[model samples]
Target: MDRFTERDQLIRKWIYAAAATIKESFDDELDIERKSNRNDLVTNMDKAIEKQFIEKIQHFFPGERILGEEGLGDEISLLDGVVWIIDPIDGTLNFVKQQDDFAIMIAIYEDGKGQLGYIYDVMQDKLYSARTGKGAYCNKRLLPTIEDRPLKEGLVAISSALMSKEEGLARTVGRASSGVRLIGSAGIETAHVASGRLIGYLAATLAPWDIAAGKIIAEEVGLIYTKLNGDKVDLLQKTPVLVASPTAHKEIIELLKSQKI
Candidate 1:
């Protein structure tokens, strides 16, 4: 347990160091590349930051399995042991364009349970983190717990694509809340929910690194995180996701369940 704490501290320091390196690397001349398609993207900084973190993790905790967004880590087909999920840059497009609204996401799992989570808002210099038994925090301050509230009065967080394009998700957003918004990053959206800036967040598609940390930290504040269809989300798979205050989550899930994609 004490060793875990020490390792946790080391990882936090590494996250800060990685963020600093990333901030310095962000320039107008980013080495950007297309992946999957034109809209899907990757950048030199993305790979560099991911490799930096992975290198440190390997140096300190050898044999731990890692699943990174940039494919720099191990390709574990299952989540059966000590594992790390890393999204070196959560908003690569934003990083390449605005250099803001991006995050470094990390999640630690031990024997199939989320043991710890971290989301670093690099530009803002805020680090959000939590251990399973510990409450979530932004920097040193604890995140306020979200109240259980229904959707009609709650501000919703969602992406433009899902709000307008994904039919079932779109209608769920349209009918389940007072408003819908997009911040372009799962880490940012979920961080806002942890801080009570929004009551819920939904995304149509995401990788493990995108939601693993957010899910751990959000649920620490009494938030509910599940798939859009309300199933267990394998932290190792691509899936639709929803995170919300429990009451708000219930409403969103019902709406999603009743609609068609």
Candidate 2:
């Protein structure tokens, strides 16, 4: 089998294993702590899940390096060789608050290029994945390329942070769209866009793990990804992003002045 095909098979198993762990912890008392502030939290489950993935990836792909949210993986400055970027639980707040709308995600890169990405919506039991030129998928079903939609024709998701801090920004975009949603999880939000359910998504700030898998899958289905300032998103940095259908991207990009972000 080709390299990614072989790795993809095993990666699915790893994601499922992570999901199993997550489901098993729902009834248990969570160990939560704040990162940057009270709003940015991490739990014991997140650390355990990241460690779990590091162990499995090391076992299967011994030489590959991993970059995980919980600092269990290697400390690499660059994506030189095979690297796995993982977010054990994308929406920790949602997981803690509602146990829904969260996801498990992994993105595999080889020599700095995205080879495969996976986003498993734990409660929904839907897996969105993609390989270069192979198209995106939701579980066993293939997703058709997203229709090139404009901002007014469909629902869009803007980060709660952005909606609260930049009401003017929200008003400019919201008045032009059908509606706005507040899905806290970037992976699930991106997957929805990949699935053509949401026309676009924006976030005030996102780490590498947040967008790693979603970027690959969303782009596989023709969603355009870039910074809020119209710059290409750097996969290794934590920055704001605007991911949408081609037309919507153009519309939103133009509506907001360069200094808006």
Candidate 3:
């Protein structure tokens, strides 16, 4: 197998292992702690999950640096070599409360280019993945390109956090669309856009681990991912992001120009 195929198989194995771990320990009492605020919580499982991936990656692909949400991996400054961006649990609040909307995610990059991406929905047991130049898939079934629809003709999602602070902005966008949804998880929301279920997903700010995996999968399926202002996102810092179908992206960009997204 070529390197992409080899690493693709390896990441699938690692993610399956993670799924099993989450299923096994989900009901147990969690050692939860707050980060940044009470709403930003982290559990023991989060740390364990990230630690597990880093260990497996080191054992199988030593010297490959990792940047995990929970800080279990290396302190990466540049994307010089093979780099892995991992989000152990994409929706910690949803995972802690509903246990339904969370996801496990990993994105592999080579010299700053996205090579492989994986997003595993823990409750549904669905895996979405992509290999650069190849197609995207969910449960091994190929996904179609995002429908090129205008904002008014398409369903879409805006971050709840973003909406609350900018209620008028949310209302404006919603009024211009068929409807609005809040998936509470970037990975899952991006998957929806990739599968043509929604035309767009917007977030005011998201970290590298939050957007990396989904960006690869969505972009491969012909969706556009960039900042609200029509700039490419740098997968190394937190920034506002818009993952949308081509038609919707252009429309949303014009609408969001005056706002501080």
Candidate 4:
């Protein structure tokens, strides 16, 4: 098997095809429904797009396992072989409300190691993709090497939920960065980190589907992708995750540990 094409090119084509389908599905208005809460949303477009990805993968790569949002894929308990993790709509809320700022994220792992990652910002027509040993890219351009920047010198991405769960994180973000920005999608935030727009990102409760592509591309550019306490991330579980340049990652972790909220 052509490992790179199986992982990167196929998924990239899948995302583009899914994007077209989703765009047509939502040309007028979206049928948005709450998943867990008002804050957690699911749309018909989300389901359709996810289904499209799952079906394409099943057709092209018959034996591969899929772990996708919207429950369109198989019930997977282990990541043993070729595993595809998909977030059909990375920002469903944004897609439903603003029709922008959402993304389609796909990541493929072989034996639990990231082999390919793709994050497509549908609204902006941007695709961020990476393959193991090939480096990351934003559309056609290869991403530059990630340079370590201090917290005070660059913007940092943090979720608003941290303000309630970890009180000090909000305060720390307020004091630490030149600015604090909240983009509803983890994929977008991590893409920014990969491109050197944001120095760091931290979120408390994220699903595996949410950050899989983000973590892969972030690390491809020499950015640190790990748990909040600086542990390696497990692609099958949820955790408090952080992605950032090396300097900002260390600083943010130390700050979070000290406050301990």
Candidate 5:
């Protein structure tokens, strides 16, 4: 097998192992700490899981660069080499409070090109993965390509905070789509879009690790992923993101322009 194939196997193994460790930690008292604010929290499980993936990556791919959410990876100044973008626990609040709805995400990019993406819904035991030029999958089942669906007929996912702050967005989405859902987990929301469960997902602000893997999987399934202004999403920058079906993507952009959002 080629290098990517080999790495894919390794990643699957590591992810399952990490998931077991995380699940076990739920039985113990969590060491939680606030990051940017009280709402932005981190737990000891997040750090430990990140460390586990980092150690395996370093041992297996010594020179590869890693940009991780937990800050346990390498100091990646550029996306030039083989880079691993990881979010150990995408929805930390859900994991801490509800013990569900969170996900572990990892993306492998070689010289700025996405090679593989993995989003494991740990609580649900669903693994969404995709390889470049290969089809996306939910566990062993292949995900169908996203069919064209008009914005008005489809369900859109957005953050509750964004919905409240941006009246224009709420109005546009409310009027255009069937309804809106606030899942509080970017990875899970993105997976829903990729799997055709949701027509689109819009985030007011998202970090690189938040959407890196989802972007790869979304693109493989023929979904359009871009900034709100229809710009290409930069993997190294945090910005507003929209992942949607082609029809919904065009319609949403038009609505945003009409509202100047």
Candidate 6:
């Protein structure tokens, strides 16, 4: 097998192993801390999981750079070589409070080009993955390309915070879509869009790790991914994100323009 194939196998194994460890600690007492704000949570499981990934990456792919959410990776100023962008626990609050709805995300990029993406819904046992030029998948089934759906007939997923703060957006999107959902998990929401269950996912503030893997997987299935202003997403900076079907993407852009969002 080629290098990517080998790495894919290794990563699949590691992800499952890590998930097992996390599940085993579900009932254990957790050491949780706040980051940035009280609402932004980080648990011991998040740190430990990131460390596990860092150790595995270092041992298996030495010299590769890792940009992780838990500060267990290198200080990467550039995506110069093989870079692994990881979010050990994407929805920490859900994991801590509900023990579900969170996901483990990892994206492998070669010289800034996304090569592989994995988002494992740990509690649900659903693994969403993608390889460059190879279609995205859920578990063992290959996902179909997203069909363009009109915004009025589609289901859109938006962050609850954004919905509450941006009244104009909430009104416009709610009026346009068949319905709206606030999942509180970027990875889960992105997966829903990629699987064609949701027509779009929009977030006002998202870090690189939040959308890195999702972007790769979403684009593989022909979803248009961009900023709220319909601009290209910068992988290095936190920005507004929109991943949607082509038809809904255009419609949402027009609506945002009308509301100046």
- Predicted model with the maximum TM-score: 6
Error of 6 at 132 (Å): 1.1
Candidate 4 residue runs with Cα over 4 Å from true position: none
Q: Local distance difference test, per candidate?
A: 0.86, 0.91, 0.90, 0.86, 0.92, 0.93
The window of 10 residues in a row where model 2 has the poorest summed lDDT is 252-261
Number of backbone-clashing residue pairs for each candidate, in the order shown = 0, 0, 0, 0, 1, 0
Clashing pairs in 3: none
Q: Which has the greatest lDDT?
A: 6
State model 6's lDDT.
Answer: 0.93
lDDT of 4 by residue, 1-261 (tens): 676775566777888888888787766667778888888999888888888888888998899999998988989888899999999999888888777888999998888898889999998899999987789999999998898888899998887666567766777765888888888898998998999999998888789999788888988999999888888888778888889899988888888788763
Clashing pairs in model 6, backbone N/Cα/C closer than 3 A: none
Could you give candidate 6's per-residue lDDT for residues 1-261 as a string of tens digits? 999999989999999998999899988999999999887999999999999999999999998999999888988888888999999999999999999999999999988889999999999999999998999999999999988888888899998777877978977987899999888899999999999999999998999899899999999999999999999998889999999999999999999999988
What does each candidate score in C-alpha RMSD? 1.5, 1.1, 1.1, 1.4, 1.0, 0.8
lDDT of 5 by residue, 119-220 (tens): 999988999999989999999999998898998888999876668678788678767899988888999999999999999998888999998999999999
lDDT of 3 by residue, 1-261 (tens): 888788888889889988898888877998889998877889999999999999999998998899999998989889988999999999998888887899999999999999899999888888999988888999979998767999999888999878987887788788889999998999999988888889899898999999999999998999999986789898888998998989898888877864554
Model 3: lowest-lDDT 10 consecutive positions: 252-261
19-135 per-residue lDDT for model 2 (tens digits): 998999989999999999887899999999999889889998898999999889988789998989999999999999999999999999888888899999999999999998899
Off by over 4 Å in 1: none
Give per-model TM-scores.
0.95, 0.97, 0.97, 0.95, 0.98, 0.98
Residue ranges of candidate 2 with Cα displaced over 4 Å: none
Model 6, residue 73: what's the lDDT? 95
lDDT over C-alpha atoms for residue 93 of model 2: 92
